[model samples]
Target: MATERMAFDDLPPAVLAGVESHAGEIVKAEMVSQGFNSEIAARVFTANGAFFVKGLRADHKRVWTQRREAEVNPFLRGIAPALRWQTEDAGWVLLGFEALNGHHADYSPGSPDLPKVADVLSRLGEVGCPDIELRHMEQRLERYAAKPSDLAHFAGNSLVHTDLNNENVMVDGPAYLVDWAWASRGAAWLDAAYWVVWLMAAGGHDPQSAERWAGRIPAWQTAAPEAVTAFALATVNVWEEIAGEDPDPWTAGIRDASRRWAEHRKAA
Candidate 1:
C-alpha cells in the first residue's frame, strides 16, 4: 500500500520547531518520492546546508522501524546517508541525514550501475554484524522457511540490508544503502541472494544470468549451493504469504521470480 505523505508545511508546529532547532531555519523543503516507509521524506534547505529527513508519528505501528534506522546509521557510514540528527518531540519521531545529490540505482540489464552496486555490496559483506540487538536472518524468515533446520544455513556474523531493491539505494559518487529498518545479521552471502530476486524483477535476466551477477561478490561465490537454494525457496514462500493476502501485481511478479530461481537451483 502507498504510504500517506505529509508536506513540510503540514508538520505540527512542535515537529517543525524541533527540526529547525537542529537543522537551522528551513528555507526550502522538497518532498522525496522514493521511499514508501516514511510518512515524511524530504530534502530540507537550512543555513547549515541540505539534509534529508524522514519521520513517522510516535504511536505508529512502524515507529520501531524509525528507531532501527537511527540505530544502524552510524555503522553504515559511507554505505548509507550520514545521520545528522534525530528528534522525538510533539508526538513524532524524526531522523535527519546528509542529503546526497543522487538518484535511485538502476538495476535493469546493461545499466552501468550494476558494477557500482556490486562494489557497495562487496564492501558491506566485509563488515561483521555489529553487537547490538538485531533480528537474525533465521529469526526474520522463520515463518517462511520450508523447514526449521533450513534456517541453520542463514546464521553468520555479517550485517545485511535485506531490502536491496533499487529504491533503497542511491547511485552517487558511490552507491549508498538507505532504509535500514530491515537490516539483519546473517550469512554474508544472504544479501547477494536477496538482490538476485530484485534483479530479475527489474527484467532481462532469467534465473541463470541473475545468479551470475550475484556470483560477482566473493561471499556469494563461496556460499553453499544448497544453502543458497534454501534461501531462494524461502523467498518464494514469503512472497506467497504476502500475495495470498493482498496479491498486488508487484508482489505476484516477485513471487514468480523467486520461484524461478528456486526451481533453477533444484535442477542444478
Candidate 2:
C-alpha cells in the first residue's frame, strides 16, 4: 500500500507550493514531533527512489543552526549522513536528503546496545567542529543566569548536542546522531551526562554500566569526574527552567540527579 502524503494545515500555501514543485509527487508526509523544535516531512516518489523533504524554520537562530551543521557535516561524513540540499523559497527553508534507515537509541534496560551507544557518543565528541560565532555558550549562559532561573554561574564551551536524548541517536550501522538544531559548543561531558539522565528516566539508568562505557571514550576518560557531574547538574537545571509549563519527566529526573551530584562533588 502506498503511503499518503502528510500535510500541515498550518503551513503557508506558498511553502506547500514550493514543496510540490520540488517533490514532483508527494507520496507520504509525516510530522516529526520528537523534539522541542518544529519540523515537517514530505516523501516523494521520484524516478530513482523516494526522496525525503524536510520543511524547517529559517529564522535567524535556526538558519545559524543549519549553517553550522552544513559546515561540520562534510568533515563527519563517515560518522553519519550529511544534509544534501538546502533551499529557501517563499518563506520556507526546504531540505532534501536521502533518508537513513535505523531506530533511535532508546535502549531498554540491560540491552546490549547501551554501552555501544555511549561509545558512539564518545566518538562523536572527537569530530572536529570549525570555529563559528553564531551561538555563544558563554553569552547564553550569562543571559539565562541573569534571569531568575536555577541555572546560574554554570558555563563551559565544548561541542554538545544540547538535546541528546535517546530519540536523537540511531542504533543501526554506525550510530548516527540526528537533529542538529540544538548542536552547539558546550561542555563535552554534559552530552554524555545528558544521555545518562535520559536513559535513567526511560528506566535504563545504570551507573556501573555507564561508568564502564565512559571508560571506552578517551575524551571522556580524561574529563574530571567533578566537571562531568557539574555539567550534568547544570544541564538539568537549565532544562527545568526552559520547560516552564510543559515539564519533561526526563529533564525533571536530570534536575534531581544534578542536585545530588553537586553535593557529592562538594564532599570530594
Per-residue alpha-carbon lDDT of model 1 for 179-245, expressed as tens digits? 8988889999998999999999888989888888898988897688889988988999888887796
Residue 144, candidate 2: Cα error in Å is 7.2
TM-score list, all predictions: 0.96, 0.75
Q: Which residue pairs come into collision in candidate 2? A: 5-29, 6-29, 158-186
Poorest 10 consecutive residues by lDDT, candidate 2: 145-154
Best by TM-score: 1
Model 1: residues >4 Å from true position, as ranges?
Answer: none
**Candidate 2 per-residue C-alpha lDDT over 1-268 given as tens digits, one digit per residue, 9 for 90 to 100:** 1122235545687776665566554555555545444355544454445555555567534455555655656555545556666667766577665666667775667776676677777777776555755354545555333243323223445566656667777777667776666666655555665565565556544554444555566666656765565555555456557656665665566666544544454465
Give the Cα error of residue 83 in candidate 2, in Å. 0.9
